[model samples]
Target: MYIEYIAMELPRKLIGSLSQFWKINVLDIKQLYDSVEKLVFVSISLEKRKTDVVRSRYNSTMRVPKALNPRLQKQLLLRFGVYETVYPVETTPSRTVPDHIEKPEYVLQKQPTVLPDKAEVKDVNQLRGMRRSCKLAANILAHVQKNIYPGITTDDIDGMVHKLTVEAGAYPSPLHYKGFPKSVCTSVNNVAVHGIPDLRPLRDGDIINVDITVSLITVITLCWHQYVNSLQNNAIKTCGPEVPFSEIGASIFRHSKRNGLTVLPAFIGHGIGRYFHGPPDIYHTLNRYRGRMRPGMTFTIEPVLSHGSKHTLILPDGWTVVTEDGARSAQAEHTVLVTEDGAEILTK
Candidate 1:
């Protein structure tokens, strides 16, 4: 499988142009972000202009376009053999923290969207904060994990997390950030992430990830927002919005093309500190994301793999992500603390 156990490096080609993508006819800018403003693009469709095959999917309002985060390089893809969509975008107002607490050194006048170096090691203070935050997050996950039996609704799990987070004197990190309503992310089998906790009950063997991130606050805010951490093993479960374009997106695409499996290319694990999602984005698929793991740095490296075709669609909620072709998926994750010699799974 995938040339695995084959001791070798092989040649590869990466597409450098958005224009060369097939079926793309028009990609225009409805607006641009000023230097003071982060670039937010109003997404538009090029489908119908290329073929009437695309003319039928619009409400006209659909063409009005929506803003997208600047990190996304390109996303227009062939869809349903007919329909198409440009993913939605969002921006957050600066978060405020107490003046007495010490903040991470990275908070800039302008929120830095760039990621830090890989496997970053944490200083004594940052490590302490991260360790405590991760433990809290893990505790929350463990508290919620007991709810995964058949029939307990996903919303129930979320409610438990929110209540516990508040009681513990921390904020539910995801609530109201980027319009996400749920505090914890409960991604059931087949739904990679951003599965808004709803009334849907769990069934037997339905593996789920109860991702908890608490804004550990008493004195300071890292990056001006709540400093958060995660739980789970050392694999690829993730909190959505934290990861934008996955580095693994490329390899998944190639491997899927070779093996006839489906690959979802939309997300990846990222560095989380003062600002919810920053750089040093961890990629699960193979690509040239240069971030490395070192002591003092923290990030998430979740990669969602599918058993079917990798196509996906944004939900009507404008946030939840799901497979378009009905493929069952699985993911695992952790907030990693790079140590002097190796990596430490804080969630453990």
Candidate 2:
């Protein structure tokens, strides 16, 4: 277990580079009320070029970046591992933005993808099996939530969760999905959703949520894009696209993006079965996700609820997401099996 724990910390080393080159500051622009665009890289992938073997190795005396939030910065230091580490690069006027991203088209958008229809389930027996898997996964998450407290880094929580999942013969589903570097979702205040787990620790007033999904290669991509378009349609109705950009727009757009980053807060959760992303898409905000809950269908119901406005900050890493307002956030998830009568929380 100790050796395995060491292996998981390897990825943070790459993410840690961001803080090394930049100093974080709140500066104002001469003309506008807002300041110059704050650039911070929140993601780094050694597997970008090579996926098979763990490529980069750092020495023992490595330094982690100071998170904008102080408690989180300390937590990251304790969570460094063989796979990753959290590097903070504070940016100042003296620093230079990387020229490698030369094109305007290189922008990254926050969006969620639409999942294909879930496969048909034959009967209750199959649903029961799926329920068991989800239940087990949920229990693991519960363990994670209980263990993760103020002063614990996100990476520490990830390490603990990864160990527990492997011990139960399950894999951390988020570890390598399209090269996502972590095992779990760690959304702090303002991070609407899809916040990568890091060395950052929970704070006294922080409300964080960790969405738990199973590790299934056979399962379709859990985050479906349809959810985003539906929400965007809702946004347009509530306020026309011509509406001025405010902090509120930030929150709305984060959830409305077609990518999987912003998950529905209210209508989150689903049934898991042979199809990991089954019918009856859990609407985050009373919206329609289409499909029905059938017996033998299993899915996750992990919603990323936030505080106040929905605007979010995308770490330069492009994956570690945070809320723009810095308000606290919280989430709870469980896989369920559609039974003859109702639903069963599998990850309890």
Candidate 3:
């Protein structure tokens, strides 16, 4: 009756603060709803297998807010059947990265090898390089974001990013990082992070995260003037040096009582320079242990916020991560330099 469906699915930590505004129901991923309902899709939680409170493993859950009309609820129950405590599961498919492009450390290694470096500040030259690479990443995302209207496939986004990154003489940072298959990360609604861009098409009212990580060690010095100058000017003007691609989802749901954007604060925005991902792991949300930003520092401030529960599930592929509740999510990231007074957005 009230705006009970407003908040996007968030983690338990934020539920206390947000629960006062909305009520929640946990549904499975296979339980499709009318895509017509704007904010009806999201990932949440529940006790699966009859009181066995299992978090996502094979079957994923999505947070469906109670604020939706009775018609929606009836449709969900009908398709999904009794909110089955014993959830029927399905196998998640996987993909591959092309051999022509360069890959990061994680692809060969069984696990992610990038770590945060503890150094407080970077040198002047280091800042310049970081700025250039971040600019490339921002530009790639900007181009991908433009093509993100309904009817476009997430895979199409990947193709565009790959072409742009290669044409710029830079590498798509995420392509083979930890065996991730795509050039850019395209997280459609209900997915948290690492949503592999595939055949899924974008829909109106749906949200997505197009995360572009670029390795510009070569590209920056070669001819950044061509790629960086054109898009760089526009990105700063529109997003104000903020990562616009990442902000789309959060902006869509920010003030909605029925749908909120829940970003992942646990994932650290690492220092990006010579190495694609390294130390000084920055916790995007609130944290007491991390150090303060200092001059010459270079790192990312990318937050992957979802439209549903903050809880997440890793797909069978091991590289792709999705919101456990099966909701829409987006990530906005920027490589920032700590200047004398404040910070500069390298990805601006």
Candidate 4:
């Protein structure tokens, strides 16, 4: 299994006087992961008024100190080459979907409002629609995977996703949803999530997550990340009936910790069906969100795991989110339905 890493740097203005100190903090993380032979992913952000100190939203156990023993800086530098930062490039206008394709409400609204607090329980017909949408989403993702390699730009991938979903007589859900410009979310290397596809071409050794969503009568979303020219490990797990929703995150957290990785807690899974997103906010980190899986309820579980710090920052685009430390990160997702006996991976 290839563990993902993401790194980010503070804005240039914040690093002015404290440049050396910030570099040391970043190096400390590099050294911490180098000992385990794992790539590290981290995000650092400071309050505008308190630019001298970085703060993390993760619990005490997961927070990385602002400073660490700087003795291993040289060793880390020698082992890991200079970190390359990925930035947004010029993107073409959003593609058009045929009039026959049904669009989600957000397409007309220009923004998806905050979802209702209660999760929707799908009826029999809704479940069938969900299954069909998810199957198509999975197939499209697989089709896109075959075309991935060096020299293919992420915007190219978005075009492919848009064409496939439209050809299947379904709408590309991400289009116009909250003003996202692309048909799919293509998160390269250090971009944790909601990455807007751009003109940047895929390079060897880069990790890219292609998140696709389709809207038929019902809606379904799934994400698949590929490690270019490298083998991938299937690290996703499924849960059975009687499992509390909260425990799902706790278990994932424990497993990631044991494997020398950290979970980016800022993003969580959610209920899906007829809408792009909804209730039962599934926190992938340890949390007290209350609820339990029940038959006929469909949702997504997409936890982003990193090799370094867990903090992240949103770019000015108002959509893309990148790690603060410029480290790499990877993500995978599946839409699932609760069954009487267990859970079924609808996107599998």
lDDT scores in order: 0.50, 0.44, 0.51, 0.70
Sort the candidates on lDDT, descending order.
Answer: 4, 3, 1, 2
The digit string of per-residue lDDT tens for model 4 on 110-187 reads 456556578676888888888888889989998998999999999999999999999999988888876888899998
RMSD of 2: 17.0
Q: Give a tens-digit lDDT track for model 3, residues 74-116.
A: 6544433322111222322333444665555555564554444
Better of 1 and 2 by lDDT: 1
Off by over 4 Å in 1: 1-121, 218-263
Deviation of model 4 at 182, angstroms? 0.7
Model 4 error, position 269 (Å):
0.3
Which wins on TM-score, candidate 2 or candidate 4? 4
Each model's Cα RMSD: 14.0, 17.0, 11.5, 10.1
TM-score of each: 0.58, 0.50, 0.60, 0.75
| Candidate scoring better on TM-score of 1 and 4 | 4
| Clashes within 3 Å, all models in order | 28, 69, 32, 16
CA lDDT, candidate 2, residue 64: 43
lDDT, candidate 2, 80-158, per-residue tens: 2112222222211211123332211111222433444553554656544555555566577657756867798766766
Candidate 3 or 1, higher TM-score: 3
Best by TM-score: 4
